[model samples]
Target: MNKKTKFITIGIIAIFSFTSLFIFSFIFFPNLQTSINSSNDNGRTLQEEVSNITIIIDYSGVKDNEIYSNITLINFNTTVYHAILNCSEIKVQDYG
Candidate 1:
Protein backbone atom coordinates (compact mmCIF):
# COMPACT_ATOMS: atom_id res chain seq x y z
CA MET A 1 0.00 0.00 0.00
CA ASN A 2 1.03 3.66 -0.42
CA LYS A 3 2.31 5.81 2.50
CA LYS A 4 -0.90 7.90 2.69
CA THR A 5 -3.15 4.81 2.76
CA LYS A 6 -1.03 3.08 5.43
CA PHE A 7 -1.08 6.14 7.70
CA ILE A 8 -4.87 6.53 7.36
CA THR A 9 -5.42 2.83 8.21
CA ILE A 10 -3.31 3.05 11.35
CA GLY A 11 -5.07 6.27 12.52
CA ILE A 12 -8.53 4.70 11.99
CA ILE A 13 -7.53 1.59 14.00
CA ALA A 14 -6.20 3.70 16.91
CA ILE A 15 -9.39 5.84 17.06
CA PHE A 16 -11.64 2.78 16.96
CA SER A 17 -9.70 1.07 19.81
CA PHE A 18 -9.86 4.17 22.04
CA THR A 19 -13.60 4.69 21.45
CA SER A 20 -14.38 1.02 22.21
CA LEU A 21 -12.51 1.19 25.55
CA PHE A 22 -14.34 4.36 26.62
CA ILE A 23 -17.77 2.82 25.81
CA PHE A 24 -16.91 -0.43 27.62
CA SER A 25 -15.93 1.32 30.85
CA PHE A 26 -19.20 3.32 30.97
CA ILE A 27 -21.31 0.17 30.30
CA PHE A 28 -19.54 -1.85 33.05
CA PHE A 29 -19.13 0.78 35.83
CA PRO A 30 -22.53 2.48 35.43
CA ASN A 31 -23.11 5.75 37.34
CA LEU A 32 -21.49 6.28 40.76
CA GLN A 33 -23.16 9.65 41.51
CA THR A 34 -26.62 8.03 41.53
CA SER A 35 -25.48 5.39 44.04
CA ILE A 36 -24.01 7.98 46.39
CA ASN A 37 -27.20 10.07 46.23
CA SER A 38 -29.35 7.02 47.05
CA SER A 39 -27.21 6.18 50.08
CA ASN A 40 -27.42 9.71 51.44
CA ASP A 41 -31.24 9.60 51.18
CA ASN A 42 -31.37 6.79 53.77
CA GLY A 43 -29.50 8.46 56.65
CA ARG A 44 -26.18 9.92 57.70
CA THR A 45 -22.98 7.93 57.17
CA LEU A 46 -21.52 5.68 59.91
CA GLN A 47 -18.85 8.21 60.85
CA GLU A 48 -21.39 11.00 61.32
CA GLU A 49 -23.66 8.87 63.54
CA VAL A 50 -20.80 7.66 65.72
CA SER A 51 -19.63 9.85 68.59
CA ASN A 52 -15.98 8.84 68.84
CA ILE A 53 -13.57 6.40 67.21
CA THR A 54 -10.12 5.64 68.60
CA ILE A 55 -7.23 3.81 66.97
CA ILE A 56 -4.28 2.76 69.17
CA ILE A 57 -1.00 1.45 67.74
CA ASP A 58 1.37 -0.50 70.01
CA TYR A 59 4.74 -0.44 68.26
CA SER A 60 6.75 -0.78 71.47
CA GLY A 61 5.76 -4.43 71.91
CA VAL A 62 6.62 -5.77 68.45
CA LYS A 63 6.66 -9.56 68.74
CA ASP A 64 7.38 -12.14 66.04
CA ASN A 65 8.13 -9.40 63.49
CA GLU A 66 4.59 -8.11 63.71
CA ILE A 67 3.04 -4.76 64.65
CA TYR A 68 -0.33 -4.67 66.40
CA SER A 69 -3.08 -2.06 66.41
CA ASN A 70 -6.41 -1.83 68.15
CA ILE A 71 -9.47 -0.01 66.79
CA THR A 72 -12.30 1.01 69.06
CA LEU A 73 -15.59 2.31 67.72
CA ILE A 74 -17.69 4.18 70.25
CA ASN A 75 -21.33 5.15 69.87
CA PHE A 76 -22.90 7.65 72.29
CA ASN A 77 -19.83 7.37 74.57
CA THR A 78 -20.20 3.55 74.71
CA THR A 79 -17.81 1.04 73.16
CA VAL A 80 -19.70 -0.71 70.35
CA TYR A 81 -17.04 -2.72 68.56
CA HIS A 82 -13.31 -3.46 68.65
CA ALA A 83 -10.98 -4.59 65.92
CA ILE A 84 -7.38 -5.83 66.18
CA LEU A 85 -5.00 -5.48 63.28
CA ASN A 86 -1.70 -7.40 63.03
CA CYS A 87 0.88 -6.74 60.33
CA SER A 88 3.18 -9.75 60.19
CA GLU A 89 5.81 -10.54 57.58
CA ILE A 90 5.13 -7.25 55.78
CA LYS A 91 8.01 -4.91 55.18
CA VAL A 92 7.46 -1.25 54.39
CA GLN A 93 10.13 0.39 52.24
CA ASP A 94 10.56 4.03 51.36
CA TYR A 95 10.71 4.56 47.63
CA GLY A 96 11.78 8.16 47.54
Candidate 2:
Protein backbone atom coordinates (compact mmCIF):
# COMPACT_ATOMS: atom_id res chain seq x y z
CA MET A 1 0.00 0.00 0.00
CA ASN A 2 1.03 3.61 -0.53
CA LYS A 3 2.13 5.80 2.42
CA LYS A 4 -1.05 7.88 2.25
CA THR A 5 -3.24 4.76 2.22
CA LYS A 6 -1.38 3.29 5.19
CA PHE A 7 -1.86 6.49 7.22
CA ILE A 8 -5.57 6.62 6.44
CA THR A 9 -5.98 2.94 7.44
CA ILE A 10 -4.21 3.55 10.74
CA GLY A 11 -6.36 6.59 11.50
CA ILE A 12 -9.58 4.69 10.79
CA ILE A 13 -8.44 1.79 12.98
CA ALA A 14 -7.59 4.11 15.86
CA ILE A 15 -10.97 5.84 15.68
CA PHE A 16 -12.82 2.53 15.51
CA SER A 17 -10.91 1.17 18.47
CA PHE A 18 -11.73 4.19 20.58
CA THR A 19 -15.40 4.10 19.61
CA SER A 20 -15.66 0.39 20.40
CA LEU A 21 -14.00 0.82 23.79
CA PHE A 22 -16.33 3.71 24.65
CA ILE A 23 -19.42 1.67 23.75
CA PHE A 24 -18.21 -1.42 25.60
CA SER A 25 -17.49 0.53 28.79
CA PHE A 26 -21.11 1.72 28.98
CA ILE A 27 -22.44 -1.77 28.19
CA PHE A 28 -20.25 -3.46 30.82
CA PHE A 29 -20.50 -0.83 33.57
CA PRO A 30 -23.84 0.94 33.50
CA ASN A 31 -23.06 3.05 36.55
CA LEU A 32 -20.19 4.65 34.70
CA GLN A 33 -22.66 6.69 32.67
CA THR A 34 -24.49 7.83 35.80
CA SER A 35 -21.27 8.97 37.44
CA ILE A 36 -20.25 10.83 34.29
CA ASN A 37 -23.63 12.57 34.15
CA SER A 38 -23.68 13.79 37.77
CA SER A 39 -22.30 13.06 41.21
CA ASN A 40 -25.75 12.59 42.74
CA ASP A 41 -27.38 9.16 42.63
CA ASN A 42 -30.39 8.26 40.43
CA GLY A 43 -30.40 11.74 38.88
CA ARG A 44 -31.52 13.30 42.14
CA THR A 45 -30.35 16.77 43.10
CA LEU A 46 -28.59 17.47 46.42
CA GLN A 47 -30.59 19.28 49.10
CA GLU A 48 -29.20 21.64 51.73
CA GLU A 49 -30.89 21.61 55.14
CA VAL A 50 -29.63 22.96 58.45
CA SER A 51 -31.10 22.27 61.86
CA ASN A 52 -30.07 21.95 65.52
CA ILE A 53 -27.33 24.49 65.08
CA THR A 54 -25.06 25.56 67.92
CA ILE A 55 -22.57 28.36 68.28
CA ILE A 56 -20.10 29.23 71.02
CA ILE A 57 -18.80 32.75 71.42
CA ASP A 58 -15.70 33.19 73.55
CA TYR A 59 -13.83 36.48 73.67
CA SER A 60 -10.16 36.69 74.53
CA GLY A 61 -10.52 39.48 77.16
CA VAL A 62 -13.97 38.53 78.47
CA LYS A 63 -14.52 36.00 81.27
CA ASP A 64 -18.13 35.04 80.53
CA ASN A 65 -18.57 33.02 77.33
CA GLU A 66 -21.86 32.77 75.41
CA ILE A 67 -23.38 29.54 74.09
CA TYR A 68 -26.17 29.60 71.47
CA SER A 69 -27.86 26.22 71.10
CA ASN A 70 -30.84 24.63 69.37
CA ILE A 71 -30.96 27.29 66.67
CA THR A 72 -32.96 25.76 63.82
CA LEU A 73 -32.46 27.44 60.47
CA ILE A 74 -34.47 26.63 57.34
CA ASN A 75 -33.21 29.08 54.75
CA PHE A 76 -31.45 28.16 51.53
CA ASN A 77 -29.38 31.36 51.67
CA THR A 78 -27.97 30.62 55.11
CA THR A 79 -24.41 31.87 55.41
CA VAL A 80 -22.01 32.51 58.30
CA TYR A 81 -23.27 36.08 58.62
CA HIS A 82 -26.90 34.98 58.29
CA ALA A 83 -26.48 32.20 60.84
CA ILE A 84 -24.93 34.62 63.30
CA LEU A 85 -27.75 37.07 62.73
CA ASN A 86 -30.37 34.33 63.14
CA CYS A 87 -29.23 33.75 66.70
CA SER A 88 -30.96 36.35 68.92
CA GLU A 89 -28.80 35.45 71.93
CA ILE A 90 -25.80 37.26 70.45
CA LYS A 91 -25.55 40.91 69.49
CA VAL A 92 -24.56 41.91 65.97
CA GLN A 93 -22.40 44.95 65.28
CA ASP A 94 -21.98 46.45 61.81
CA TYR A 95 -18.81 48.42 61.27
CA GLY A 96 -19.47 49.30 57.69
Candidate 3:
Protein backbone atom coordinates (compact mmCIF):
# COMPACT_ATOMS: atom_id res chain seq x y z
CA MET A 1 0.00 0.00 0.00
CA ASN A 2 1.07 3.64 -0.55
CA LYS A 3 2.30 5.82 2.35
CA LYS A 4 -0.85 7.97 2.30
CA THR A 5 -3.18 4.94 2.27
CA LYS A 6 -1.22 3.26 5.08
CA PHE A 7 -1.43 6.42 7.19
CA ILE A 8 -5.17 6.69 6.63
CA THR A 9 -5.72 3.05 7.59
CA ILE A 10 -3.66 3.47 10.77
CA GLY A 11 -5.63 6.56 11.73
CA ILE A 12 -8.94 4.73 11.29
CA ILE A 13 -7.70 1.76 13.31
CA ALA A 14 -6.48 4.01 16.12
CA ILE A 15 -9.84 5.84 16.34
CA PHE A 16 -11.77 2.54 16.40
CA SER A 17 -9.48 1.08 19.06
CA PHE A 18 -9.87 4.11 21.35
CA THR A 19 -13.66 4.15 20.93
CA SER A 20 -13.89 0.40 21.67
CA LEU A 21 -11.76 0.75 24.79
CA PHE A 22 -13.87 3.63 26.07
CA ILE A 23 -17.09 1.69 25.59
CA PHE A 24 -15.57 -1.47 27.13
CA SER A 25 -14.45 0.46 30.23
CA PHE A 26 -17.97 1.70 30.84
CA ILE A 27 -19.34 -1.83 30.62
CA PHE A 28 -16.60 -3.38 32.79
CA PHE A 29 -16.70 -0.71 35.49
CA PRO A 30 -20.25 -0.51 36.78
CA ASN A 31 -19.34 2.10 39.40
CA LEU A 32 -17.97 4.41 36.71
CA GLN A 33 -21.46 4.65 35.25
CA THR A 34 -23.79 7.27 36.74
CA SER A 35 -27.10 5.90 37.98
CA ILE A 36 -30.06 7.41 39.79
CA ASN A 37 -32.38 5.77 42.28
CA SER A 38 -35.17 3.90 40.52
CA SER A 39 -37.57 4.39 43.45
CA ASN A 40 -38.56 7.87 42.29
CA ASP A 41 -42.17 8.61 41.37
CA ASN A 42 -41.20 8.30 37.74
CA GLY A 43 -38.76 5.45 37.16
CA ARG A 44 -36.56 7.50 34.88
CA THR A 45 -32.95 8.60 35.09
CA LEU A 46 -31.99 12.10 36.22
CA GLN A 47 -31.24 13.21 32.67
CA GLU A 48 -34.55 11.83 31.45
CA GLU A 49 -36.49 13.54 34.25
CA VAL A 50 -34.86 16.90 33.62
CA SER A 51 -35.43 16.64 29.88
CA ASN A 52 -39.20 16.19 30.41
CA ILE A 53 -39.71 19.71 31.70
CA THR A 54 -41.08 22.25 29.22
CA ILE A 55 -41.04 25.98 29.88
CA ILE A 56 -42.26 28.74 27.59
CA ILE A 57 -42.11 32.52 28.01
CA ASP A 58 -43.62 35.30 25.95
CA TYR A 59 -41.75 38.62 25.51
CA SER A 60 -44.15 40.21 23.03
CA GLY A 61 -45.73 42.27 25.83
CA VAL A 62 -42.56 44.39 26.03
CA LYS A 63 -42.65 46.83 23.17
CA ASP A 64 -39.57 48.50 21.68
CA ASN A 65 -41.27 51.94 21.98
CA GLU A 66 -41.60 51.58 25.78
CA ILE A 67 -37.90 51.06 26.42
CA TYR A 68 -35.02 53.53 26.12
CA SER A 69 -32.01 52.84 23.92
CA ASN A 70 -29.69 52.69 26.94
CA ILE A 71 -31.90 50.32 28.93
CA THR A 72 -31.56 46.57 28.59
CA LEU A 73 -34.65 44.39 28.89
CA ILE A 74 -34.35 40.83 30.13
CA ASN A 75 -37.15 38.35 30.70
CA PHE A 76 -37.30 34.70 31.70
CA ASN A 77 -39.65 31.96 32.90
CA THR A 78 -38.93 29.55 35.74
CA THR A 79 -40.15 25.96 35.97
CA VAL A 80 -39.77 23.49 38.83
CA TYR A 81 -40.21 19.80 38.12
CA HIS A 82 -41.64 18.16 41.23
CA ALA A 83 -41.08 14.71 39.75
CA ILE A 84 -37.35 15.09 40.25
CA LEU A 85 -37.87 15.79 43.95
CA ASN A 86 -40.04 12.73 44.43
CA CYS A 87 -37.03 10.49 44.84
CA SER A 88 -36.90 8.46 48.05
CA GLU A 89 -33.35 9.57 48.83
CA ILE A 90 -34.19 13.30 48.68
CA LYS A 91 -35.44 15.39 51.57
CA VAL A 92 -37.07 18.80 51.07
CA GLN A 93 -37.47 21.49 53.70
CA ASP A 94 -40.30 23.99 53.86
CA TYR A 95 -39.31 27.45 55.14
CA GLY A 96 -42.83 28.75 55.10
Of 1 and 3, the candidate ahead on TM-score is 1
Pairs of residues clashing in candidate 3: none
In model 1, the worst 10-residue window by lDDT is 79-88
Clashes of 2: 0
Task: Please provide the root mean square deviation of candidate 1 (C-alpha atoms, Å).
Answer: 9.3
Tell me each candidate's TM-score: 0.38, 0.39, 0.30
Candidate 2 lDDT for residue 15: 100
Off by over 4 Å in 1: 27-38, 41-73, 76-96
lDDT of candidate 3 over 1-96, digit per residue (tens): 999999999999999999989888877775764446646655453332223343333347684322212222122212243432332134678999
Candidate 3, run of 10 with poorest lDDT? 68-77
| lDDT of model 2 at position 67 | 83
Q: Highest TM-score, which number?
A: 2
Candidate 2 achieves a global lDDT of 0.72
Q: How well is each residue in 10-71 modelled by candidate 1, as lDDT tens digits?
A: 99999999998888778766673464446687543555233234444456757433333343
